[model samples]
Target: MDENQEAWYLWRHVQTQLRVSFGGIVGVDYTALRHVAGILGITLDTAMLHKIQALESVLLKKVK
Candidate 1:
């Protein structure tokens, strides 16, 4: 995928995760994230793992 596609894929998944994990706590759109797995064609754990890896890579870069 292209950069935009990759960024969008990541962003959408992260947004969904945040909305699910923190929607009630932070007022994210809970409804929008309720069906994230169906919408993204990924298991929740798979998406979360990738997001965490992406986060780790960014932090590692900051330490470099």
Candidate 2:
């Protein structure tokens, strides 16, 4: 897959895992997300990390 596609794939899986492991976005911190990404062998670049952070923030806000 292309870089963008790969990033999305990683994001979806990581998000799912965070929800499953932590019981939802409220319990998912960036550190834990990064650790899980590492375990999944996904390398996150600065831009991708920023995007993930932004999305996580949105999710957290919604949960609140």
The prediction achieving the highest lDDT against the true structure is: 2
TM-score (all chains, Cα) for each model: 0.32, 0.53
- Per-residue C-alpha lDDT of model 1 across residues 1-64, encoded as one tens digit per residue: 5534543564555553432233233322434444654577744465555654565456445544
Candidate 2 wrong stretches, greater than 4 Å = 1-4, 16-27, 39-41
Best by TM-score: 2
- For model 2, residues 1-64, the per-residue Cα lDDT tens digits are 6756656666676665454335545544567677777877878779778777766777678876
Clashing pairs in 1: none
Model 1 lDDT on a 0 to 1 scale:
0.48
Would you give me the overall lDDT of model 2? 0.67
RMSD of 2: 4.2
The lDDT values for all models are: 0.48, 0.67
